[model samples]
Target: MSSTTETFEQYLHNFIESDWLSAIHTLLPEIHEVDRNAVQIWFRFYPLSLFRYLQSAEDLEKAVQGFAMLGRYELKDQIDTSHHFLYGHRYWKTVKAAIEAEAVVFENDDIDLAEEIRQLAAMSAEKLKIDVSLVIAIAAVGMMTLNQTGLENFKNAADGIQKPTGLMAKSPDKIVSERSKDDSQGVFGFLKTVNKKYSIIYDEKRNDGRFAITSDQEIAGASALDRSQNWQEKDSRCWEGVIPVECLSASCGTCWIGVIAGQEKLSEVSRRERKQMKVFGYNQPEGERPFMRLSCQAKASGNATIVIPPWNGVFGKKIYQNVQDVELEPATTSARELRKVVSEAAINKAE
Candidate 1:
């Protein structure tokens, strides 16, 4: 590598700065064509702004919801329009834990910290494959910002390894597979009208394949909510790519989503969606079409891939206040404990 490149990698030691992402970019120097598209999607996770909210969130679920709302109500001139939402939501807990483990390992006298980090990254790549870079990148972000106790908590969360499920991800694999079939005709070939379908792959797990969008319905309208409700009504099998929904009129934030691809083809963010998105703390007055959109409001115009957040809420200005509270906490405090305090405070308010 050139002297400038070596210097840049050295600067990456302080992973807090948004500029540190450039080092991550350098890691993927030679890309295969098949992996090219995935690389672009991964690139979206950098520059920190795209995912600063990830740190602000108290838990994996809130972090997922926050990013989903941001994507659903994407502004035309939004500042952080990146695909970090994809990998961040999926592997955040694991990666956060791994980083905390790194911190604990940092305290060890015999371990080679740099070598250990590389080994962790390599192992992550071997295991998670598609999402390893994202995992390492986000781990870098946490290492830069978290204090020792917070790191311990993060490590604890990772060690626990009990993954949280996002509302949009409650789709049944069998139904998704049945729907994904090339159904040029009915189950018995009696129906002959071939529907114009588009593909939408959820969760970034490519082996899982794409969910067939048989119509131009918004993701919420076309999702597993329909099948879930049907199952409730009758003993029917639930379908896949289902996002949580209530009121479907942009009244609830449950159906919020982040578009990782094909944002241009989705309908423009309507005025009502924009208003709700802001009320939900999903968007700022930066621009329109900021990659975040309500799955209900955003009618897919073509094929796309999206990431569903784990939870949703209606905090409005209070969301900003909550963020402020997190920021004000002493760096040495355990993040897990702070989250518990926040959760308790919220519950007390409800009571």
Candidate 2:
């Protein structure tokens, strides 16, 4: 039920990372870019480093001490649907049960993780008549759920969701094909406006969740969101954009998104954007085109797919830089203690 055991420590060696996730693209070139990118985005959404570090720590309480604002508990609640954006999401219920059964064998170190994934992927593909590549991605999602919530809680989710929601009903091929469509040839196009129109899928949950962009104005993607009447109902105080944008500049970090597919379609990160991402503690602010990006600063060049994180905050630098200070020595720190520690830290900082 807990990760503070030898089996989990051993399993950590074969753990998946961005490198391995990226290599899957080469291994399964037939896999649609949407499925591939969704897997990667899922990894970014639930960072493995954070999982491994906490599970392996001598004291779980101290490990989670200052990360209160990071909402570690909140993430585990959605572990099951984390990969809902993947093409084969419909097969998650079957996939999860398979993983739960295998998790016990993993604890005994009787089977290798990769071999199990391949076998599960093959069986699920055959049973559901879906692609094994997609199954493999969903299997990784199962493993992620187990890793964070532990086996007991993982098994507790047996009933599973009744079905896939929203945009999931759309064919993946349709979403992929829509990327090539360009609507820049209207009257606006003739008037030297709306140049090189591109489609951007922001909320994969909804089939209608997208907007258009043109090369004419070098405006960022969030700014472009406001231009589209096609988006969902409007909101107040945030420029009526689907994606929340406060500063319009990257300073607020409210409009960040994970570029699930078509990373190359977006312009490279600007100096200001990179600095703000790290300051907000998004993704260590690494690389020119890291998957994590500030939507307000990212300008679309061609069609792209992105997922807006459920929440945003400015705790990256403050929390990560000072994590070591809060680590304590206990494997059983209750959630209340976690909150108290963070609350006290806040009070001290205020003083």
TM-score of each: 0.46, 0.69
Pick the lDDT winner. 2
Whole-structure CA lDDT of model 2? 0.58
Go through the candidates in order and give each one's C-alpha lDDT: 0.44, 0.58
Clashing pairs in 2: 62-328, 281-316
The parts of candidate 2 lying over 4 Å away from their true place are 1-31, 51-73, 107-116, 158-167, 187-198, 205-207, 212-240, 284-290, 314-351
Q: Best candidate per TM-score, number? A: 2
Candidate 2: worst-modelled 10 consecutive residues by lDDT: 323-332
Q: For each predicted model, how many residue pairs clash, with residues at least 3 apart or on different chains?
A: 21, 2
**Residues 1-351 of candidate 1: C-alpha lDDT, one tens digit per residue:** 344323323333434433343443444443222222333333332223334444455684654443333223221122122223333334555555555444433433343334434455555556566534444543433443342123323333322222324322333333233323342433655443345566665644443444556555777666753332343233111123356555456655556666655666677788777766654545422345556778878876566666655445444434333222211121222323233433333232210
